[model samples]
Target: MGLSSRSVFGLVVSVGLAGAVGAQVTLPPPAPRPEMPEYVPPSQRVDEEEPAFDPSSVEFDPIWTLDEDGKVVGPDGLAEIAALRHNPLITEDLFPIIETILEDRAKEMDTKVFVYPRKAIDALTGAIDNFDVRKEDTRNVMGEIANSLNVSEGLVSWLRDQGLITEEMSMVSFNIMQDYTKRTMDQIAASMPDADQLDLISHQSRFLVRLGLQEPLSAFGRLSRKVLELHPDVVENAAELLELKGRDFLDEVAKALKPLDDDQLKALFKEAYESLHGPVVNSADTDEKIEGKPVGDR
Candidate 1:
């Protein structure tokens, strides 16, 4: 028998619950590196002897000039002077490569900066949800999330105190409130027990209804259904495994998935569908379809 609407909703909620719980897992802090040996002065060094310089073998490659316009004159002299003036060797050629490298490094740093706070928030929320952590901890976590995102939670009160604000300012304030509301809802949902799930859902549904956002919620439901249809078993299996094995299931699944060959995995994926659709007809193959001609005529 086909799954009922209630069953589908339950599945989606179950997945969300697992994600909310899994997000709480805390990773161990990285270990500190060993310190290097202290540096010693050349005069007091005991490691090795310094090499003596040979004055006879030394060569000087001096810059050439004709004493006219103080310009250098020699093979590649113009290029060398230009290199000194503009640092062309570093700027024109290597600068792009250096800039690209720095940009990539900056992106990585930004990712870490964003990710660490998020992880901390998830862990904090999870603790508050499951372990009955203090309300103050939740505030701290929210503060960290705001700080990491470069957002201020005090904007709502600040806007209100302004007495009169622009439409754009009001919209921005509304957006912040919406974001905060969504995040609070997630935390509330995460904290609730299985029995409270329906209650939480009902509360959220009513909230959405009051805000006239039921249509968007329905659209999201439709989009989720489409996604489920595309990969039916993966979602079901993941949910099932998460429920059975708890948090460690993902690690186990990752390890298990690593050994599967591409062809084997493809075969498993193909099994999800009862029958594959035939290749799409190209525009060049037949103008009949494009011209609204009958399939039989084609």
Candidate 2:
């Protein structure tokens, strides 16, 4: 079905600017990020041995099977459970990769960010149903920009009135800007903690935020979008995601992989204590195990 043409002209309010084009936006509650073991830094856990997603190897299940009673079992049931994981191919043990990405992003303290005002009327005409996202998202971004004093919706509307923005492009940009803002700004705030955490957040927070708190998450999101976009049949697009259902999907994948090559991966996970994070040569003799065999655990 096509998106409705009716929502293109909806207005957002700006800092007390009622029904104005751009406005200070309020974001919805963010889901809590699950805690992981603090003993090992995320980078050391996954290390470089972990493989990146192989686009060709991905296979998605089609048509969730159901019994006469509509209950699923066996492989079909397993798939129903697996499908709940965002990308079945990517496992939950891979959370470290995300943290690694966040850590890496911290090095980029000067990434350039642009704030666009709003798209003109002609552009906003047909963007209502593209992703089934809420209209208020745009309002929040508009509010963000307006609060930031970047631009206003009225000005953008005037430009559209002047034939600058095509109707189709307006709404798309309207939501796109909102999306960029919603996804990035707070992430930068959250992942990149202020001075408060430094005395406490371990050195990781400083490095990750400077590198780009949003990079790993962005990389994850990109990979997810790419997988679904490339294989629309095997995956759910943002529309079908419903809510933050992707987290559950990843958890199942983690369970599936928890046992595969366990001893080897566990060994590798622990190897960091020596090779990647060896603090002193003498300390190595203190006591440790490598590959289920004792390094010095005599």
Candidate 3:
């Protein structure tokens, strides 16, 4: 007949206990662990060959890209140039070519010096009326002049700031200032009713110029005297200039000169003069004279 529910449950539990205790079971050897394909070196691999490199498929960027005007366009070119600074060996072979280009550029720039006086006068005419020379703002005015002339104010002030006037001043600034100062003095002379007499006084007495060339420390004193002489009703005292915080353009230039010894000053002056005016001309030989008598007479 049919088994009772309690008897069936006991029979199932007994079977599970027997299996848990000692039943030896096989898992059919894990499906034989399918064999992996034999290892192949990339060189010997035929099915997975790397695609051949195609020159046509590759894209290239130009080292230099130029605009319509032939000027380099993007920072890409500049970056290429800047990268050369670190790898100096790459540039060692390029220096001669670079120097030749620089020499050509310098020659081109040097020719611009001749037009400085006219350009300076034009700039002063437009801007001079608002400039007050009595104040410390004179330096700012000079800076404006420097900007108009494309002469860097930083370059001009470098010697003064570094106290290294023995090196050199910016030639462009020097030439511009020389002409500008002359024009300024001319304007001052012209404002007077006795302009001709004032001009004569200035022309005859180059004492200020000589004093400045001799001792740059005394240069500002010369400027003060010239200003006072030209504008007696305008300026109070030479010492009033000292109130401009002990510094102005002229004061800076004078101070810059103070660091240089006489020999250095002479050398610097000679170099500057030569740069503006070609080499100095040697004097023609003169025959020796005896006792204030001409050599022919003797």
What is the full ranking by lDDT, best candidate first?
A: 3, 1, 2
Candidate 1 overall Cα lDDT vs. reference? 0.37
Q: Write the per-residue lDDT of candidate 2 for residues 1-298, one digit (tens) a residue.
A: 7535554333222334563335656667999999975797666776568575443344434323446854432222222122223334435675454445433232111110111111111011222112112345633533342233211222223334545444433343334333333434444456456535433233333222212212222222223333334334433233353233343433232232233353432232233222323333443332231112211122
* Cα error of candidate 3 at position 63, Å: 29
When summed lDDT is taken over every stretch of 10 residues in candidate 2, the lowest stretch is 108-117
Candidate 3 residue lDDT tens string, 1-298 = 9999999999999998789667676445556777899999998978768775433332323333456854433222122222232222233555465444434333222222222223233332333333333444643654444432332222224333434222222333343333334554454455465646644454423322322222111222333333333444432343454444322434433333444455544344434434544663431211121112311232
Is 1 or 2 the stronger prediction by lDDT?
1
For model 1, the stretches where C-alpha displacement exceeds 4 angstroms are: 1-150, 153-169, 172-298
List, residue by residue over 137-199, the lDDT tens digit for candidate 1. Answer: 544654443333221212223223443333333444344334434654565466565636556
Q: Clashes in model 1: which pairs?
A: none
Backbone clashes, each candidate: 0, 29, 0
TM-score of 1: 0.18
